[model samples]
Target: MSTFEFKKNIHLIKILNLKATNINELIEGLKKIPLNSVYYHTHRFLKQHQSISPEPPNDFAYWIEKALNMKKLSEIVASVNIVEFNKLWELKNKYIEVIKKNTIPYERKKKCNKNEEFVFMGCKTFIIPTGDTASNLPEFYEKLKIIESSSIYFHIFESRLRIDSQINDFQLWLNENSYSAVAEEIGKIDPYNMTVENLRRKILNIIEKHL
Candidate 1:
């Protein structure tokens, strides 16, 4: 196994709030943040789609590396054949090991900016500063403009249902974490009837008020 490789679980996205300055610290931070999706909808997606996934191991590598810019680690995972694994845990262990080995020291890269706008599932949110200030209101609303123009709220969920369940799992995760209120607001939207723009507005509205 390469030293730069570690076992990966998309569930890590649920822990994105953990502060880390480097890959090594991020791994440690993840260890402390309990996983919210280990036995959640992930199982359903795997059981229904593994045999049909379009090169799942490679696809998995692509997204993880894209999120973190960890090329070597993705390369290692990209080489595996999912068909050979008898169980998900086996593959999961392989990913975990990749993270374990990926500890070479480097400048800490914050995976997300609390102040910078976060666009996920085509909805927008930001790191709401603790206190209100006249200066922040304008900048915060500007983030809303970006979301109003573009949002992917339902697209990822509907699309990834074929290959991955993380999209749905992430929504469930938000409900359980700090975004519980926002998640509740999202839950009330009727995906069957709403347009992408409508869902985007609902999510952004929640985030705008809270967030």
Candidate 2:
């Protein structure tokens, strides 16, 4: 059996030099921006406000509603359940579809003021080992408690997008190790609905219950 080596990621955010003052430009930027930019904008809120409620609308939804004053369209875009998306492109497409499907052709070109332009941004992600390794369930549970919240975020949120898999690192490792029942419990957790600290506690409780 192989040990699960824990890892964490650091992101260096950069301006994509893309800005949108209207719905049409926003859609064009969405289609033209790098996948990393899409990922950053979508998940930026989650990563930055780990202690806050996870219901904060994503950057696009926030800007669209606030700047463009497209409350209904913004709500529709925000309502796209990001948890269901395993890939960045999938998430991007959903946003594009929601916007296009909801708006009339003339409405698509409606513009916001110059001050309220939506600026596109991206990040360079660097993954590194945390020097934490677990060979079995007991060790896994113990490490889960002490690891940084970012590590929890990485394993649960970022890993799926990175690997282009529907399941997360913890669940994948657990299932591979014949802990399918435990993995199933983990799969039921909605990481988007709670603080990362809460997520960590929930995961620990799940693992402890089975121990």
Candidate 3:
């Protein structure tokens, strides 16, 4: 059999209401819609409501309520021929699991770093000569390259000079080239003084020099 001929069974499309309770039964009902119609409807739905959270319903009743609010459900039902809705249901369940597991870790990391303070420094701009020498450096060099290329001024005072030569080179280059470099270093503070708004402002000021 030809490759195309080997695939005889085509899945139908089904647009479900976010609040459907009997999801398994609903998936069965969608087996009549075409795959192409389902794909198009799903794309349109996502484009229109990109901000909707991917969380699963707490109960069947909740699913029913969500499904009712889906504006494109009818369009999906009419256009697509769905062979199986089980895969879609499984996919959504997996997404919810991932979100739940990741959310806590992300929030914890942000919270733990709340008391951290960093200084604003003048930015550096230089094209790295690409060759074998560049390839052997640590991954941190790639991050530095991105920061240098995009930033106009860096938060200098917040940064500790790990290498004396680097500090000297920066001072010499700025003076010799006559490029403006502005920086302010804030002293380290306790967690009580690390307000979120202040941190945001400091970061914005650093970014503004680059633009």
Give candidate 2's TM-score.
0.94
Please tell me which predicted candidate would have the highest lDDT against the true structure: 2
Per-residue lDDT of candidate 3, residues 1-211 (tens digit): 1110000111233433321123333333234333333233333222223234542212222222344332233233322322122244333333234323333433312211222211111122232332212111132223233343112121221111212222322233333433334222212221112232343345345435543
* Per-model TM values vs. the true structure: 0.29, 0.94, 0.18
Q: Which 10-residue window in model 1 sums to the lowest lDDT? A: 1-10
Native-structure RMSD, model 3: 23.1
Writing each residue's lDDT as its tens digit, candidate 1 over 106-130 gives 5234353343222111112222222
What would the TM-score be for candidate 1 when compared with the true structure?
0.29
Q: Rank the candidates by TM-score, best first.
A: 2, 1, 3
RMSD of 1: 18.2
Candidate order by decreasing lDDT: 2, 1, 3
